[model samples]
Target: MSKGENTRKRIIAKSAELFNQKGYASSSLSDITELTGIKKGGIYRHFASKDEIAVEAYKYAGSIVSGKIHEALDRETTATGKLLVFLKVYENVVEAPPFIGGCPLLNLATESDDGDPVLRENARRGLDNTLELMKRIITEGVRSGEFKADLDVDALATFALSIMEGGIMLSKLDGDNRHVRSNIDSLTAYLKTVAAAS
Candidate 1:
């Protein structure tokens, strides 16, 4: 990579880490520069402002976590399997650092709080897209006889998103995985009750 490209990437990477660790509101350009070892001028060459880095960094983080979910959902051969896989994916995500602060969408949504239009819109889109994905899976499950014919896919999907986000928030605040597991278990049980036999 060119020197300029490398420096830009370094800034984005460092910003992502700090944002995930301290949140968007708390992280500053100085924190990013200190962690990246890049000069303010060099960073300016890449990003115009902290808001720019935040928008890009938050997008990067969202893509990372979403990629994992996409992978899990893609690997499952059945709708029921995919549904279960979604729960498992969150359970696994709770294991380590990047995910320790919980879902970036939730963080950005709450922290931005109608502040940064870009970040808030991105978070809104991410959340909406995630719910849509879940709804699609549930819709397919019903068509394939894996979910109840009369099931309310949209309602269930909204609930799934709520529980997962709430669970992650609680897990992060409490610094424990139990809430995450509990949420997954509750989701699983709820799905089973609504599932249709193949």
Candidate 2:
């Protein structure tokens, strides 16, 4: 990569961490400059405004999360195993987050809902992508005779996502992992009930 490209990526990486922790409204250009050790002019040279930087940073952060999920999915062969891995990944993340704060989609969605349109949309897309992943897994399970054919893929996917995200939110708010653990247990039980007979 060129020097300019490297600098832009560095800025995005630093900004993503700051945005995840402090959020877009609270995080400032000064914070980015401090975190990246890049001058204000240099940052401006790459990003036209804070909004532009935030959009790219959000995408970068989401990609990190998506990459982890994909990695976990790749490790499993069966659809059921993939779903279990997905839950396990979230459980681990609750106990030890990969990022500084927590799930960027959750954090960004809650903080930017009514505040920043660009960020809100970015977060929405991240969430939609997650739902799509779950849907694919469930659909595969049904097709492979691992899950009941009558299952509602869309509803189940939405419920699973809601349970996971809700658990994360509660766990973060209370500074305890019990909420997430309990939710994971419940989800596991639900999954088993839906599984086809061996």
Name the candidate that leads on TM-score.
2
Please give the distance, in angstroms, between residue 2's alpha carbon in candidate 1 and its true position after superposition.
2.7
| Residue pairs whose backbone atoms clash in candidate 1 | none
| Candidate 2, backbone clash total | 0
- lDDT tens digits by residue: candidate 2, 1-198: 999999999999999999988888999899999999999999999999999998998888888877887898898998767766655666755458756678888988999998888888888888888889899999999999989999999999998888888887888788888877888889888989998989
Give me the candidate number with maximum lDDT.
2
* All candidates: CA RMSD (Å): 1.8, 1.4
Q: Can you write out model 1's per-residue Cα lDDT over 77-158, one digit (the tens) per residue? A: 7776776665566664456733535678888889877788888898888888888888899899899888899999999888
RMSD of 2: 1.4
Instruction: Report model 1's TM-score to 2 decimal places.
Output: 0.92
Off by over 4 Å in 1: 92-100
